[model samples]
Target chain A: MTSSHLVYLIALPLFSSAFLILMGRKADKWGHIFATLISAAVFGVGVSEFMAMHSRAGDMRAVTQHLFSWISVGTFQVDASLLLDQLSICFVLLISGVGTLIHIYSIAYMSHDKDRRRFFAYLNFFIAAMLLLVLGDSYLNLYVGWEGVGLASYLLIGFWNQKPTYATAAKKAFVANRVGDVGLSLAIMIAFAQFGSVTFDGVKAGVHGASPAALTALGAMLLLAAAGKSAQFPLQSWLGDAMAGPTPVSALIHAATMVTAGVYLITRSNFIFDGSSTARLLVVIVGGITLLFGALIGTAKDDIKKALAASTMSQIGYMILASGLGPVGYAIAIMHLLTHGFFKAGMFLGAGSVMHGMDDEVNMRRYGAIGKVMPITFATFGLGYLAIIGVPPFAGFYSKDKIIEIAFNAGGTKGIILGGATLLGAAITAFYMTRLMVMTFAGSKRWDDKAHPHESPVLMWLPMVVLAIGSVATGFLFNSGNSLVNWLAPVLNPNNVESGSELMKPIVVSSLALLAVILGVALAVTKYRTVPVEAPEDVSIFTKVARRDLLQDAFNETVLMRPGQILTAGLVKTDYFAIDGLVRLIGAVVSGTSTFLRRIQNGYVRSYALIMVIGALALIATIWVVTL
Target chain B: MDISNYLYLSAILFTIGAIGVVVRRNAIVVFMCVELMLNAANLAFVTFSRINGNLDGQVASFFTMVVAACEVVVGLAIIVTMYRSRRSASVDDASLLKR
Candidate 1:
């Protein structure tokens, strides 16, 4: 198949979403079915495209289809185009493939909602935007998709708008993303200013000639954008709150597609990051800090969706960190992103299944011994848990272990620090994920008398079962013999190959990672297997800090939001007392003069006649004086 | 009589009518005063026609009298409606337009 065939992958969902929206409530009866079929068809197109690309000759594997000239003015131009390249092909498959499963799952998950058609429409819209994001050939096109996804996410997150908090969460997510979008838009402007082009290939070609400072600025700005979209470091507070959206939204947009756009962007621009060591190190530092940041927060969250959201943050952190590792880490980042797409989407679906069974209660403390009640959810969630913790033979083991091994082999004191950070993150990840599983599914019943935990419908579990199998098998399939690495070699630099150290060999890194997982699991099982009645109030300061997301919210308020509020308040005062006061003064003068003059307009016809005669006499006298 | 004397007499009648219109509260008295001012203007026009040795001013007076008759028809209908609605013909009581 030619590159033109890639349009099907994007167009199917785009048209379906448009149709659903246009049809509105009239299509509510079968809108979800239409959405699911469209998503599945897109996945089918992605698979075909991937297969055709895989079968092509070297360098022929990449294809670009130019649709039209999007913008052109005096030596600057961009195209509305699509690219089916090695890097983007992976994103296409992950978005559409997992999107299909989530679409199916949402049919049952959102069955009771009166606006299920609208929900499916938003889901399809998200898929289309994500596809555009990955497939676009230029930064301008990517930004169009970027804002499109942001809009879709805002709509989905606030789908149940009757609740005020849900609306707040959606607004917060939108506002926070807009902050990062500024960074992206500025970076694109800089790209065009410096390189005279915003296309991926054009920018990549121009990076060699550009000054180091310009490249660093571009890279740093891109990192900011990524951090916002992927929920890294300072911008991450919105992701947990985003769980106020429907469970399917949390699964598809938050856990799977929308959040990983950051990694894809960074990796897509690997050439730039590969050029600037300072920028690359910044990416690594942000990722390293965020991984630990998310893991710490994950350990303290009691809400199931929030905890999972935290875990998603930490996982994306790992991918970002890997992308920052330079060219060697790009393939690893993409691999991890793909596998993460499978397992995380599965785990979130499992969480949704658990919520379905447990009357939509999200507090994990009130959950226990639900494994027997929801065997499929437990089984799928268990597999995903194993995959995430980097257990042997599972998906995360292959992908995440490669990243850990690369960090160790980075070869310096900085390398060791980053490596240790990655190792610590892995252990924390294992601990929290295990704690989640044990508290939720392993212990004695903690449910109240009114609770009736049972299995979700076949539609929900079927997707979970497919994803669970992928969670088990995808890592080994992608990583063994470096199949994904070789496939991505033409687009990404292949120089940063795995250079195992004598001290930190692959076996040694794998064993160490495994040991950390084992330790984390043992700690969680010992503490939470027989669940406690209530959390102890007098916990250590560190635990307290972690539980409150290390006061990240407070930090944001004091540092960012509070200052903004103060400035706004000052402006408002100025408007009220100064700007509006001027207007008020003019209005008062006019009204006061009118009030004095208004008595002359009293409805007495005789008074009006007298005034008219006196006015006529004065006019005649003035005319007589002037003539004289 | 001298035309100047007639003009002076007409001016005095018009002034009294104008004063009466300003001070009077009753609608009927205001209407009668307005008619007196119109008759004074008609007398001045007839005297001016005699002095100018032409009939233009007399014809104007005739047209004015026709217009006055039509005005009286419309004005009395409105006055009658006002009296029926408000139980009074005092112009002060017709100040609903003030609102």
Candidate 2:
């Protein structure tokens, strides 16, 4: 296949989404199946393209397809083009591959929903947008895809918008994403100003000529955009609330596509980040903070999907943190991303399966020992759990341990601090994930008599089983010979060489990471081995704060929303009084003067004659005066 | 006679007619005063033509005499209708347009 087929990778899902939506309720019975088939078809296309690329050598692996001239001006030009390269191929497979599985799962999960067709349409739209995001060759072209995914995410999150809170959650996510989008816009503008072009190739070639200050600014702005999309730190309050969406949506956003966009953006812009150590350090710090932030929140969440969402945030944090570690960390971050996509998506689908059996009850406190009833969900979800905790031979072990190794090998005090943080994040991740497992599957049954936990249909568990297999195998396979790293070197680090000495050996790092996981697991098992049906009312201040999402919303309201509200109110008052008052004053003066002048029109003939005679006398007097 | 003296007599007659038209309330009186003013203007035109030894002013006086004749016909008719409608000849009775 030629590179021109790249367009179909995006267009197929996009047009199918549009078609299903336009067909409306008439296609309800088969709309979901049609959507699934389209997703699978897109995946097939991506696989064929991958096979074609694999047959080629180093320089030829990356291919570009130019569709048309997008924008042109004096010395400024852009093309609507697509790039199917090593880095994007990984994302393509993950998005469409995991996306297809989620689609299959949704067929059964959403079968009872009357608007299931609309849900599939949104899912297809999300897949198309995500594909565009990775395949776009330039920052400007990528923006279209960025916004596309944001819209899809908003629509899917609010799919059950009859509930007011669900609608509000969607709005929150959209607003937060807008904040990040501003960063992307600014970064693109900076790139254009500095390099005179916005294409990835152009920017990479020009980066050597650009000043460090400009590069740092560009890098910082890109990171800001990543932070928004990936739910890192201050911009991340929406991820937990976003769980108000359906379970498949959570899996798609957290595991497969939407949140991983941040990692893709940073890695794609590796040239800029490499030039700016300040920006790189900032990315690492944000990643470090958010990993802990999400892990802490995960430990306190009662809702099962929300807990998984928190873990997704923390896992992305590891990827972001790893990407920030410079050349050595980029491939490792993507490896973790791919693995996280598998395990996290599988776990979320498993959660959905559990929900399907338990009347959509989301509280883990209310869910205990349902694993006995739903064996496939339990087994698949357990495999994912093991993978997430970085247990040996699992996907997370290879990827996450590599990130931990890289962090420690960064050298000096920086390495020590970053290494410590990753280690701590690993421990907390283990604790929260173990707590989730024990509460949902290990403890005594906490549900009421009305609840009957049963296995989901074959359609639902099949996808989970496949992803669970991925979680158990993908990390080892990708790490066996550093194949993923070597494959991505042309894009991430063309002059690749091992430059640094290790502060901690890979074996040491693995041991420490495993120890941390064991410690966290032991604590969680001992503490939550017997969870009460009802959560205790009196908790420590830390638990209380964590339970409330660490006051992120409160901080935003006080620091951002309140000031914005005040400013808007002041502007409104000024417009009403100052601007409008001036117009009102002008009108009043004209009307008042007209009223005063109107009194002279008395209807008496004698008075009119007297005035006319006086006017004639005055005219004669004026003539005499002028002559004299 | 000198033409200046004729002009002064015409101006005095015109002023008197104007005062009569403004002060008198009777519609018939006002009509007669307007005719007087028009004739005074025609007298001034004849005097000016004699002084200048030109036919232009004489032709103008003839034109004024024609217009005055037409005015008298229309003005007298309007005054008759006003008297018939209001049962009074006062020009003040037709002041409805003041406001």
Using lDDT as the measure, the top candidate is 2
- The digit string of per-residue lDDT tens for model 2 on A465-541 reads 99999999999889888899999999998879573798867888999999999999999999997888778879999
Is model 1 an incorrect, acceptable, medium or high docking prediction?
Answer: medium
Off by over 4 Å in 1: A494-503, A583-628, B1-99
What shift in Å separates residue A244 of candidate 1 from its native position after superposition? Answer: 1.2
Q: Supply DockQ values for each candidate.
A: 0.54, 0.46
Model 1, position A555, has a per-residue lDDT of 91
- A445-560 in candidate 1: lDDT tens per residue? 88888999999999999999999999999999997788999889888865645554544778988999999999998988887767665777798999899888889889999999
RMSD of 1: 6.6
What CA root-mean-square deviation does each model show from the true structure? 6.6, 3.2
Evaluate model 2: give its lDDT. 0.93
Clashing pairs in 1: none
